[model samples]
Target: MNTLEQRYQFISLLGQGGMGKVYLAEDTKLSRKKWAIKEIPLTGMQRKQVISEVEILTKLNHQHLPRIVDYYTDEQQQHIYVVMDYIEGTTLQEVLKQKGVMDWKDTLHYSLQICDVFIYLHHDLAEPIIYRDLKPSNIMITKQNEVKLIDFGIARSYNQEKQDDTIKLGTIGFAAPEQFLDGQSDHRTDLYTLGSLIYFAISGKRYDQHATTPLHHVAKVPQELSSIVQKLTKHDAGERYQSAAEVKHALYKLLNKHDNNKKEQSITPMNIGTVMISVIATHKGMGSTHTAMMVAHHLNKKGYKVALIEANKSNEFKYIEEDYDGKQHKEVQTSCFSMHGVTYYKCEPTIEIATVIRLQYDFIILDIGCDLNQAWMGEFRRSQLRLVVGSAATWKKQKILDFVQQYEKEETKDWVYCIPFAESDQMLEIKSELRSKRMYAVPSNPYPMKLQEKTIAVFDEVLDHLPLNQKKKRLSIWWLLVPTSLVLAGIYVMMIVRM
Candidate 1:
């Protein structure tokens, strides 16, 4: 008997894959414990990858993941092997095949368990781990109905400091759009796969990554589940849930709603359209940055997706931009990121990119570094709101009035709002001097303060004026008028000819 045979007894072959063959084995020394033994033909590159996986596994201990029992490296024989707990039941792929499709309740149950493993892998560890490959075949369901993730061959610890691509590994229909590009894989990459898995479990159909319509439209999936899936699987990584914790939170909400049978509480998707607002400084000292930041944050708190943009040529946010991830937008020239509950972008003052940004967010807060000028006038005119900020100084107030009077059209006046930075007395003084009655005053606190009642009122006013996306009205039978008209014309001609 060989030395390897001394420790374990091979029962039978279970399965084989491109990388290795797995066998059913029993540990001879430990009460004949059942284990899975994977045998792989060593190639130099694959040998290094296997070693890396072992290093990662040594540090991981999770209920949902398989525990590493033993590993062997035989350089002379050009082969290597690993032993781990043999899951008692079948793979999710097999289960799906047998059952056709799982019920929403069961699917949600499995999805929540998967999220737990993801949170543990991405956050609990000292260094975040990116599960490069996540698919049905890699997951096993034990007799106890517990899920155990098996393959870690391609998983790697994510390097947040590095912005370049380190490695690319994923399965078709499960890989995020970033993996196919020069993009770095992070926590969001695994989120994309989770979305695809949920889609498959519910629809019993493979996900098409490029599909536009929501899952609810094509299948029996619920709208709430479908909406979350859409966000998770979005091609743009920034648009996806920021972290596994966030995804778990969303899933729990849906689970609670379903369990409570709150059918009437079902959410109707908001008709949020593109509403762009520009907050430009009337002078250098006026607080454009503070005003724009506050307003954007306020809207975000109201559940609107708002993006605060630094479009000024001076790039006033240079200090803030210094610490953001460098590899954020490798393909795109511009830098856009989400932080502290708000998305921020440093962009050139041009209409082209503004149009693109408008489509993605419900509102864009443009910090026109300085007073509005010709460079951004085109977009300013088209914007839903133009908020000009200035100090309480008479010169600045006059400048604001003159600017608005010259450029503000009679038809566009309703879209324009003004904010004056001042103290209690200064604000009242500015109101008397300023020509525009639509002006709102924001208190100047050298230190941070809560959103003031005046600021909230201003935001509420703005929201009231902005249009909401109404449910699209379906075409009625009235559209048949043209065909009916033609039919009547033909009948009249036939009658005339017969006469």
Candidate 2:
């Protein structure tokens, strides 16, 4: 075929299957943009099936799924052409062939990504979709290490009325037993395939049902990961993980366990002191104070002596004290208070951070607000971890870019960019542009004083590699009152009063 719809120019054939052919084509109508054109021959009855597939593909909007741009039927060619994003990457199968076997950590990373896609397909959609085929060949790993599920030819919507699949379709090794037994496949079927895929990814061996071999026997996989894989590959669908979310949670737990072990092993005697976290924002109203409070409370709950210091001249902490004390009058002044096991210090402009560091808190969270001026830059630079909270909105995105550009000269490995209320796609785009995985989406927390699971999870990932101070000591009430005297004594203070 020379060209289809007088727009897409065929460049080269990408691949061919029993269904049809996929070509790497360029859209002449859209500035010569590259796209994958799928040409599937259609019979009279098969046209309806192709139409249903097109409907499902076009409606999907996900970061891990390919976008379907256009579809058309060429009656003379007797084929339906579907246009989609040209994914530039190597298949997982090719990677396995080149490397022989993958590291267990890499396998777990890709598995978690696949679980995210599965969760979106199974639970996030209006009608659940069960991916009937899942194998290394079907999974694509981008240059940036992002996982993308390429083909959806055999994917079908879940139907409670049907007891069995009308058409049984799946690969031999990766397909669950139910797929070939005339039994209906559900979300659990995909989980089973994920198990098989994980096994092959780590060991470079196909999973066999008849002569079952434990993953640990073939590969040096972690015990937790092996247990999760075993549970996922159970012969009975009921015995397997019920949903992709469950599998994801299990994988995350395993990852955390591995990370905690590494942290413990890497800890040294010199690094066992107090760790400071500085929280700042690109601009005002970007949730710096809220993010600091959330982290402080979370660390406090984890049995750390967490002190939230107002490192900037913001009234956020003073307001928080007033609100907590049930005093509506603005005349009430409390420079220091303790709530929820976290000590809050409302520092004055002359308060010195060195003095606070001498107090020996396990974790000192400096809420610097949006003040990136030289006055607060010293404290921000001294912190072990620096969190820059910024808006993810399109108009406000430039603020974050500007902030990064200003600090480009400094070492940024300790810096983390946080966008509040950011969607998955937004976070992915920003992360790609920034070329940093330290970026995280801060979940919405209406009550910063209370701990939320989602928010805590973000912090868990952020602080996973950091060594925690094992020497835990409770904060005394006298230590809280010391900040009040320091502020009144006209010493350097980082006065933080709530908005």
Candidate 3:
């Protein structure tokens, strides 16, 4: 066991990859932190690809994920290793193969928690996140059965992918329908995989009788957990959970519903009320930021105490090309963030959103930064609502709807509401589609253009455009759900909690 601070510190090869090797290293700095360094073979294009991979992982941090502590090159082979929280635990696949399926309760408990991890990664972020792969080998379970999902080599910052890809990429047993067809994926694809994992948990199989028709197969799940899993695994995005928060809620409900009299665990649960939060999402440059600013401006003009939280990196260090007094000035820092004369807060990673609730603001418009790994995004789940923004084009509308449905189903959460950003023609199509799906009052046609304006300014017009008494999914402090719901296909709910 040689210990040195060199690049090849104690070359005990932990694992070998096609790209290169994973070495177990003793970090000389930072208290000799143990890191699993992934070294990519240095070739012509390999170097560039390695660089891009490192950039993607360097900025990511989540409770269920490993953080990238360091990245650099050592010797001829480019060293691109991510310093992760070394898990001495065995991979779930290994555990299952060696130890066999544990007690049903234990298996269910573990699988449900794993669902939480994906839920957090997807809807919990300001920008939607997508975990393209879900399988036993990729999941790790500790001695205490805590799940830590790893291997983001192919993950993207997204919650959903609308329209299947022409080609599919996933392990045969675990891939979803859309994945196999190269169709669109979103938050729901991960849920489908999750449902499959749970199927392995409750029963001794990886998939149910009709795994493809998950919504129909949902009734086989045990208790209220069935609702959560069915919704998450719906074949069509329209019938699924819309966000990770919703999934969390379903988990909470299933977990507590049974033991209403049981004592609850330690919780300084987020104090949230009235104050709403919505993220305007679209392909970058679709003017979502502008829409958010417009809504905020309109809300402010209506005598409402509103706050617009910007997750966009551009919000800070923004550039303004101005002809101030006929002199061309590029990149000017201006206070143009306030949505339509409304008071807004330009924020960073660790934000105090509780203050907004305490202030009793009637509304808050947030620019859900498309950039993944935002600091303030985790806090937005405490908000009263979410507004998804996309153009009225059929493709865009379908994408948004697909995302919401997937997120909701996979997470088993009900959205406060969904409002699509549309153009006039798209709005007509959207209206017809919404009616067909039994979802009414699809957002207004071409609400208002605030391209050169802030996104919050359009809040007022969007609000009025909301249909009479929007559909709201009632929330519970602790959403306790069962895990066998998918297997049993029943909406059984009971609580065992501190009442």
Candidate 4:
């Protein structure tokens, strides 16, 4: 077999069934799109069955159904390759097993929808079809709670003129009686299996839910549908529903009755905010660390509880300098949080990102060196942001700008915000350059502790771009404390308030 892992970028193996294995793989030929690749080992009649199912599913264009996108045999190896839409969501079997059944209304609602799916598949197809296998695992629910019937591997088109065109294949306990005896099946065979399916659904377990109950004390099937249930399980092939449509209509009617007693399915949307990831990239001598630290520090002081992640390994100790000429400590009333100048470096930039993100910080700004395609840099680009910071040199700015533009053309959401450094007499020219590049310009001045008016305004602009859902409150500003009479007096006032 052609190991798909050798060629295409492959995600994890999703499932391994009796027929084959399904993998979530990336199709580079399809513009690096995602596809669910199924590798089936064909034997005797199985190859024919796989080919026919692929042909049928390709023609199927239902929104709820998964469509087959590509099909080709790997002649070098000897297996058939089938690629289809990789639908998201857990299986119905998983939901039932995990949630431990459900309320009568929920169960009825699920069964009712499954019936509708059968109706759509049978009546809507060019030629009516019969899904020989109807089991919980085969039916999947989307993230939106929309029902989807999957695994068309065993489905076959119905024959009107021919009488005995049945096949001997289906799940054992869930199969109709005639299917076990012989291939004496038709659309009615599907209906019988569906009835068994509903029986399992209503009972809130497998068909054998009440298997251990005493035979004399077993719950009785209703008089109206007792014969219908018996016909489904009848040893004789002659005794069953005429078609899948009949069974579907019956289940839908029950569904309406169930809905009349209570409300139907309700799906609520989750709250998604504007959380983005950005990497700060620059040359080795460009002072990218200082720029990144200043940006994070400015945003944090302006009424936002921001998180500063140290993405570089070299400057972890230098940035957190223990001695800073008594300037790191300053006074500001609006800065309600720890106003000791900076949160400093905490994120130890390692190859292992899973360990890095555990220390939660709001804005994860990665300070990157000139190295573009390193392992961790690639991982950072895959993040929500990839920022390139350049210095006063035009070539440096141009190189970084070209990188951002190329990335932006490929992905619109990825953005590159530029910041130029100017500590000399060329401050006015630096501002002009920033405006030309359509970027935010910063004045080379004393750090934020001086609480300058211009620096504070710039902080507000960064705050606007920050995550808006942050909850704000007065912060405990005692991270660094020197005992004094003032502290005692403050405690006294707090004690009186408690009283």
Candidate 5:
């Protein structure tokens, strides 16, 4: 008997079924690479069917699909083996058995990954391939938290003109009703199985074939997700999503809405460390609002909780806000709003507002306009970062130069950062000239500020150097009492307004 010992070192038996025994093996030539080899006793007739399936597997190139490496028969020709990429993780069925049920977020994430794999199989392929056996046992959750589809033993190409599959295929619980009725198994068949699979993963309960309300008994499932799963599992293929792409889009929408709602609900006051940034204009006609807006927009896009406040006496960002939809926050008096996932406030940097905002946001950028008086300068001096922004034009450069020279002599000069706004072509020259000073220059960015890695790196360098407050303020009983009372008063006011 010739075993696989010549080319591959067998590690252990992975699993066995009626079809074959799978072994964890490592290639002798590529010792570091591991593979799963399925050994099946095949007669002469069985070889032809397996060859056709192997051709399809050999051509598959997807991140989530297992890659077939090689196939060989021993000297006796009684058994043949199929070698494939070893997915190092438990099956979804095993995960559910051990963990009971998964959180909706986790279930949704896994489901979306599975949907992406199906999208490739059904749409991206030359001929749409139907994964007839769609079940948790066939889906591997890798150690790296990636979902890998395995066991394409019964997968077949879908011919749109055909009326039905040649054979009935799929697991009993997860299979669509059409699969048993001699009806065609298409994209919708996979969607049906996916819905049942998701329901099982989330609820920790087996999907009941007779149950009309699959997700109804699972209370923790979000209403939005419930609606999607219900539609996907509809017995009638016409009622379900037409393609895997459609299911993915629907799930993505729910995820986005869930994230936005999570952000909205987290307005409670806490002792979170926050950095207050002051973007002060060194000269008139300098783009202070522009600088503040751009910086805040970038930070927010970088996953930081940022709020841009118009603290200048003149409403410099007025035009910008008016152009916005102006429906973020309904409190007309506060003029506080959210746009482009960043919050903006049209209010002076008063002590009370500043203190409250410091608790709510990671970064609060104050657009203090062009007026640098004693009171304004005093407030700017206290900030963790105070930037003097101005134009780089010859006339404007004089004011910036004078301001930098005078600023160097100040006690809080280390906190001062200079940013000269120049045309896109002059950024390199401006940066080189101001290299000696702790200064930054702006490159021309597209309007509305789309997120860019390079732009984020620049902002990251600026933020990383800004010193964090290390001294925790010891609070007296009165210190806590005041905020507690304020919270109660605010709650009362909200209740009264509702009445």
Candidate 6:
């Protein structure tokens, strides 16, 4: 049919599967906006199933999910049609076919996006929705590098009272053990399929639960990420990650660790440029402002132009001006002061990051206070590097967990955690609990102006390729040569005196 509902006009056939055909359609009533029209032949029970799918799609409102605009049944033709947003992209299956295998970073990015959709379905709704099927063909990647999940034919809402699903659904290799074993598939089932999807994305091969080979052994995947995949694909649902949030957090930790390694390896004397670093505290009294100031001064002393910005509502910079400088400056949109060769910008309601970026400083440091509701989060996300100043105390550790979990949807690859006054063992414990290696124990600095050796060492490790550290290494070599030369001169003078 050329037109349905007297509005959607069929343009071309997009694709066809066992269920039905999808067509590219244009809305005649509107400005010819494109949409995907799926037509499935009505059967004994399929008409009700199609209605169920429509209900699920209508309730969804996520960037990665398609919007169901219209749906109707063609009684004369015995077919049901669904009109939805036309996702213009290639499926993961097509990408895998062209490239054979995807890079781990690219796979991780897509996986994280899929997890966001899962979280919306499983936890954000009144009734939990279990996406019974997840495979490469169901995932689409746009030209702008965005992910979209398609094909909800097998999706179903979960019921806690039910002991088992009415029907067994899902692809063979990608399906969880419970899906095939007559057990009720739940949120963990989707996670199991996600692990298989990741394995297939990185290895260009299906994950065989029976095979002794592991994911890392088959592909050039990181052991930590591969281990997460293994945990996700465990035979028992209880053994797998219980929720998509947990899986997302584990993936975030892996991505952060990998990115830290790459950054440390890539840093060199020639490539040093304007780097933005954001410092945020998990709670009040976490010393985030002090940590930011110390970092600014340290970088400035290393012969780099540094700008320290107060992007939060703490007004610590204003307090410093009144107490230390003996003058209180009125707060405006932005105010500036200088201390220890570091330029400080007191920003009210947060200053434009672009404006500060245009000044072209070697390093721009933002101090984001404990309030997560502030507008400075945009700047924190835009910054090239992030430092989370949190407590290492066991009781206060929950704050750090909460902070990270809150932003689990964002990219955490460049994030580094700094715990003030934390012992080495404490840092180790937190790192292990979070499954992250991008953590540092910051020593207390009473005088922010003075750069202590311990503080310098911590910064040196966190921010690799410091000019000061390089100069010290050169000086150390000369230090060894100078002492040897003086000893030789003394021995020569003694021999001359004897002669």
Candidate number of the best lDDT: 6
lDDT of candidate 2 vs native?
Answer: 0.79
Candidate 1: give its CA RMSD in angstroms. Answer: 20.3
RMSD (Å) of each candidate, 1 decimal: 20.3, 21.1, 20.7, 18.8, 18.5, 19.0
Ten-residue segment with the worst summed lDDT in candidate 3? 318-327
List where candidate 4 sits over 4 angstroms from the true fold: 1-8, 44-46, 161-167, 208-240, 258-499
Question: 1-499 in candidate 4: lDDT tens per residue?
Answer: 3345344457779888877888888765445656688777767766676687677766665435666655777764457778776777888788878776444445544554565556656776677777778777887876445566777656778777665544567787677665656454566666666656555654555573222432113333333343445555554556666655565455445545444556753221111121334545655665556556665666555443344445555643343442231113432111011223333433333233432232223444555545455665665656565454565554565554455555554453444444544444443454454443334445554463444576556545544444544433222233223356579889999999999
lDDT of candidate model 4 versus the reference: 0.55
* Model 3's TM-score against the true structure: 0.46
Off by over 4 Å in 2: 207-211, 264-499
Task: For residues 399-494, write the lDDT of model 2, one tens digit per residue.
Answer: 888878888888775689878999998888877776777998988899987868888888888877566542222245567778988877654343
Candidate 5 C-alpha lDDT tens digits along 1-499: 2347477778889887656788888777553457799887767786766666676766775656776657887777787788887887899889888899888888877887788788878987788788877788888986546688988866788888989887676788888888889689998998898988888778775675324665746648678788888888888999999998798778867876776687743222233356778888877667777777778887777566777877776764545554553223332322454556566777545434434352246788888877777776776787778777766676566676676667666753454444544664454554455554455655555464564565556566666665432122324666888999999999999999999
Best by TM-score: 2
Estimate every model's Cα lDDT from 0 to 1: 0.69, 0.79, 0.53, 0.55, 0.71, 0.80
For each candidate in turn, the TM-score is: 0.51, 0.56, 0.46, 0.48, 0.54, 0.55
- Model 4 residue pairs with clashes: 277-385
What TM-score quantifies how close candidate 4 is to the native fold? 0.48
- Per-residue CA lDDT of model 3 for 34-122, tens digit only, reads 66666555666656765765665655554346555457665555455455445557887787787555444455556556655666566
Pairs that collide, model 5: none
CA deviation > 4 Å runs, candidate 6: 207-211, 264-499
Regions of model 5 farther than 4 Å from truth: 41-45, 75-78, 264-499
Badly placed stretches (over 4 Å) of model 3 are: 1-5, 8-11, 16-21, 40-50, 73-79, 102-108, 111-116, 124-127, 159-168, 207-223, 261-499
lDDT of 1 at 236: 85
Give the lDDT of residue 299 in candidate 1: 79
